[model samples]
Target chain A: MLNRVLHRRTSALVCSALTAALTGCGGGVDVIGYDVTIQQTSQCTVTGAAARNCEDPAVLGQTSLAARWFLETADDGVSVTVTTHEGRTIPGLLFDNNTNVINTEGCAGEGGRCVFVRRRYQTSDVNTGCSTFGELIFVGHFPPDAPQRLVGRFSDVAGNTEECGTPTINEVVFSVNGAKVEQPAQSLEGARP
Target chain B: MNRPLPMSPVLVGLAIGFAGCAGDGIDFFEVVRSRVDECAIRSNGEFCVEPEQFDPPTVEVWAVETRAEVALLYVDEEVWVLDPLPGDADPATVERTATKTSVVIDGLTGCRTDAVREVGFLSVVTRSAFGTTGTLDGSLSVRSVLTGPESCGSTPVGERTVDVVSGTVSGP
Candidate 1:
């Protein structure tokens, strides 16, 4: 009975130590999915497109969804892609390792990794659209040695053009806990010829 | 003391013929000048002169799979890559070939910014083709921002739009 109690205590101590190490390093935990929150701080209007402090609770919410996070590393740079099950994809958030900074922001100062985020949304008119491009700072150590996980946050004003009807400008914050997966095959159906 | 001599019609005709030949020769030289020469003559931007001043200035054109074509302009140490605009295509496949034009100075300090593609103001004048020698012409207004600690102290550095105008990329 004493031997059994000692064995149980050792196992519990080891588990606790492992948990502390993982949490302290800000990594090594494979989360099920990402929790994303997007808030539009500016009231979007076509008439007078000016930045005014407006908050809509309907636009501010959180969702947990299944996503596929892919990381491609080259000698020159590293790029990440997050594709959700709903077919909403954020592609090519590139972090050029060759240069120590991305989008004029120092990655080394922020713990040696950064990704430049540039996303565009357009209307069917082709001429009507808005672009959001800025720096996405890594929360913990990025480009993990195993290439399995990524955690980052972004909170900045996205600039947009006037032709986008109203500024579809928004502030996005996301935390991704990605797992390693094979490169998805490109589908030819509905592809532009 | 000398009376005006009557000019021979044949001599006058020969003079006119020689002038016409000289004019034709000038036109031929103008038409046959290489694209590099044309770029030198027409461009007044820093990109035009720096490439020539540096050693091993070369302009290379290659395709990015089936998405778009790319042009690389390399001087002694500085390099600039031209990123063309993707038209009605999947942006994911052509992200590198898309509108983010980048430049690396001294092979150390670098900056990448999206080209301000207004309707008529900023556009690629000529896009280089794959496997064939071509010329690249356009004006790009890139945000003057540098990356890395090596670039933090670089001169003329600020967060402003720097206009690189009348740039031409052609073979050495």
Candidate 2:
């Protein structure tokens, strides 16, 4: 049913499998209806409060590349979001909320790609209160070289005359159900696009 | 110019004693500290006088992975020096010190909890005595807000300072 053979940072992949399986389409395909082939090329960690804790493979969309689950691309790169049903974590609060912007376009490199990053952004799967991660939504304004650590200089936070630079990208590759990612993302689950 | 004074057995013995001060009967780091003083006379880069006798304490090290690569960070020693004021009688006069501390890095190694960030504050070398020594109970202050695709949709994660305290290095 749940092909747990996916890649690094356990949380995101497990969630992806869970999210996909909830629809009842068992046997190796994801909820959005894509064939599954787990690739071992990945690195990820769970961030608790600070310093991105270790072991949650699906924590960051860039590094872990677990964004394939909630990623909602409307036939074009014109808009991007990850949402769930309930849409609000608290009563009268926005759960499927694309409310917080984590970063802004500053100099050149930062604006490289994936413009306008946001966190706790809810776009699909509005089912409320599923588990610990149910309320948390993640998004990344990614550049081609998405996977990374320490984007800006750590010293910059010290407010010194130092400016942080994006670290070198190690790897970034997207795939859809055993096939490479293509525009219009091959009709979710072969039926519900 | 002061002319050389005639030397006797007692003077020779004393000279031998002074030169031998760096040999033993003192902190091995003192030997290293002296080497630093001697090297600074010719260069500006940091020169640690790791004495031959110095029992280097072990250090804890760690690493982090970025998308395409892995960055390693570790605990190490930081050194500081107090320079002599300008126009002083002796311009070369100065004091040196060391502190064992930790900070975020691409990668790091060669430090341990048992080791001290031995802060050495060396005053002008007096003929009658060696320099003084001081230490802060072991402590460490390091932090970073790593922004990447690891946390949430290209957001910053673990962006905070960590304060660690140990014996001898009180931490800052």
Candidate 3:
């Protein structure tokens, strides 16, 4: 009977709708993940520097050392959650190379460039404290004749009297540059001397 | 011959089983969905309102200008580690740690203002070290109450939605 046939089809539709709802609620999807580890080395330039704490007023005006970083970005990158040694989760941004660096101070100074890039949002556990730390990810094609190193200086914008150095990153692997290239001892952290 | 009526006990037991599964178990799902819905609502308030409460947080970032003596300038920042206070945990337990060690500025300062914008989860360059003349890179977490340019008034907005975002800063 037509009623019997219609009943069978209706049952099938109900089952299909339930499956779709569950899947839409963060189920049955393959998501990619990754992790990053940062290590500090002795290559830092500043010496005898006062520690800067936000909670303290006396040391309020000072330039803390720029934390050096090296990052990797991938679309098919494996999905692995990241946590600190202290059992805390770390939030990170996708590495993008195509960014613009602009100078904030007048052109009279040499080191006033700000790099801008779009964000690539991944995932995190909402219940946990896991979140993202927005840092620029580099991904783009450099001109064949583009210079390898960009020049700049670091100064104490605060009244504190201290000599700081440049920021550099070493051991860079251009993963997206068509050819897999590796540069040993790439320094992107320290101030240029 | 005609079939007799189904047994009374059999029919009653079947009805009870159907009612139990349909009524009680379904509520568990409803509870979870409601929790998520509440979070989504909170995220909306965080995005739409300015200088959202440091409590019941959704997403926020900070830019700290640590103006020290002329010779030694520095910047340090802190941000909420967890989303705004949900029902189960104590709000005071949400502690924030800097992205890196060695630098100072771990805690909130006394000169905090309430003026804030709905930045969601974005990190603004709170401070740039001196060597960044050519290109400087930095990162920090912000406290909602400390770093803002304005102050939140009494009877602040309630029941807002919040979002978690990952961001980056590069170039000069």
Each candidate structure's TM-score, on Cα atoms with residue i matched to residue i, is 0.27, 0.17, 0.18
For candidate 2, the docking band is incorrect
TM-scores for chain B, listed for all candidates? 0.22, 0.23, 0.17
Per-model tally of clashing residue pairs: 0, 63, 92
Q: Which stretches of candidate 1 lie over 4 Å from their true place?
A: A1-62, A74-99, A103-114, A117-147, A154-168, A181-193, B1-172
Q: Rank the candidates by lDDT, best first.
A: 1, 3, 2
lDDT tens readout by residue for model 3, A11-54 = 54444445344433212222211122222211212223433222
Candidate 2 per-residue C-alpha lDDT over A1-193 given as tens digits, one digit per residue, 9 for 90 to 100: 2523222223343444453345322222111211222222233333222343233334322221111222333323344442211111111111111224334322134443332223322233235322221122222333334322102110000011111222121222222122223321222213210
lDDT for each candidate structure? 0.32, 0.25, 0.25
Error of 3 at A106 (Å): 28
Please name the candidate that would achieve the greatest TM-score relative to the true structure: 1
Candidate 2 residues lying further than 4 Å off, grouped into runs, are A1-193, B1-10, B13-135, B148-152, B159-161, B164-172
Q: Give the clash count for model 3.
A: 92
Q: What is the lDDT of residue A129 in candidate 3?
A: 35
Q: What would the TM-score be for candidate 1 when compared with the true structure? A: 0.27
Native contacts retained by model 2, as a fraction? Answer: 0.00
- Angstrom error of the Cα, residue B136, model 2: value is 3.2
lDDT of 1 by residue, B1-172 (tens): 3333233433443443343332111000001111221112111222233334433323333221211122222222222232333465432333221122222232223332111111011212223365232222323232333333444454333332222222233332
lDDT tens per residue, model 1, A1-193: 9965555555554444454344332122121222222222223322234554454534432223232322323324445544332223344545534445443433444444555544455333455554434333333234535334444543333545555454445444444444443322211111111
Stretches of model 3 off by over 4 angstroms after superposition: A1-81, A84-86, A92-193, B1-172
